[model samples]
Target: MPEFIPLISRQTIQNRVREIGKQISRDYQGKDLILTGILKGAFMFMADLTRQIDMDHDIDFIGASSYEGTHSTGQIVFTKQPDLEYRNRDILLVEDIVDTGNTLTKIMEFIQLLNPNSVAVCTLIDKHERRKKAIPVKYACFSLEKGFIVGYGLDYDEKYRNKPEIYDLKL
Candidate 1:
């Protein structure tokens, strides 16, 4: 088995998720909200987040990919998108991690076409050193300079996603 170095603990992640959820619930208290998750990676984060929200909101999923194995291909490919009407709904785009920001730009562009009332982003992890696009992340759990993390719904070549805590995949 490949060695894994600990990064964010499971307890830390849970605390952050609950904090962010409460903030979102307060922000969108009187609006029709839709939490649209960017799939595969964001599944675990979204599930935990929504439960702590403490408000009525809808959920949906959109799948986007740019990774081929453990590396990013620098190309955005979306495999799924939400079917609900976005014209007048408040959209919270949830993502697992933001590295180059390329995939996020594409997702924002696609969602904008539906003319949602407003759209904001919430991400579990942010890699500041790898960002190539200026995408504003409204809510985030953790930020890192550089590292390959796999766990808590994040995977390395479709493995290690089931781990409860975040870890740096030692290569």
Candidate 2:
């Protein structure tokens, strides 16, 4: 097994998720909130976050893939999208991590084409230094250092996602 070093504890993640949810509820009070979760990564975070959000919000999933064994292929091939029409709706895109910003930019651009009232981004982890585009992260739980992270919905080779806490995959 590859060595794993503890990063964020499970308790810490739960606390942060609740905080982000509260903030979102406050900011989007009385609005039609639609959360678009980027799939295969943000599924866990999306579930926890949406539960904490004390509003009647709709949830949807958008599947976009760009990783090939820990390296982004620099191309986002969208495989799935939401069925609901996003016109004039407050759309929040939830992501597991924001790294190169390429995938998120492409996803946001695609959503923008739907004529949504507004679009915002919320990420569980922000790899700020790796960003290549000026994508705004309206809400972020943690800012990760330069390293390969796994667990707590993040994975390496599709493993470690079941772990309840975040860890650094020590190579």
Candidate 3:
């Protein structure tokens, strides 16, 4: 086990999420918006964010996994699917973080097959430098350095997911 220091505090994360929610609410006002939460990791952020999105929108969840322990598994497993028709609808994909871009790439590709009118991504944090694939993020709260982060839904070996603050591993 390694010691870790808090990176984004709980209050800071809440404030940032409010800001992001305001932006999304403004952008999709009066439009049919479908929120797709990338499950497990994004669950906390998605729940809080949706409460601030003042719009008539539907919510769905998808569970995808590309990591095990502290490493990328290099494969994506979609354990759950979003049960909604995406055709001609604006879709927002909510994610906890975008790291390496492999998982996001596969997710975007899979969503595109549904023929949505538009598809955009919103992430709580982004590791821009670690992106291996060219995946564009439409909305992001912050760009983080390359580090092992946990908390606010991110986890290490399935621990720390419930931590209110975000912390970086000392190693």
Q: Rate the local accuracy (lDDT) of all candidates.
A: 0.93, 0.92, 0.90
By summed lDDT, the worst window of 10 consecutive residues in model 1 runs over: 69-78
lDDT of 3: 0.90
Candidate achieving higher lDDT, 1 or 2: 1
* TM-score for each predicted model, relative to the true structure: 0.97, 0.97, 0.96
Give the total clashing residue pairs for model 1.
0
1-171 per-residue lDDT for model 3 (tens digits):
589897998899999999999999999998889999998899999999999888789999888999989889899999998899999899999999999999988999999999999999999898866789977899998888788899889988788889888999775
Clashing pairs in 1: none
* lDDT string, candidate 2, 16-102, tens digits: 999999999999999999999998889999999999999998999999989987888998999898888899899999999999999
Give the residue spans of candidate 3 off by over 4 A.
Answer: none
**Residue 42 CA displacement from its true place in model 2, Å:** 0.3
Candidate 1 lDDT over 59-147, as tens digits, reads: 99999999987778988888997978899899999999988899999999999999999999999998877788999999989989998
- Structure candidate 2, residue pairs in collision: none
**Candidate 2: which stretches are off by over 4 Å?**
none
Candidate 3 lDDT score at position 9: 88
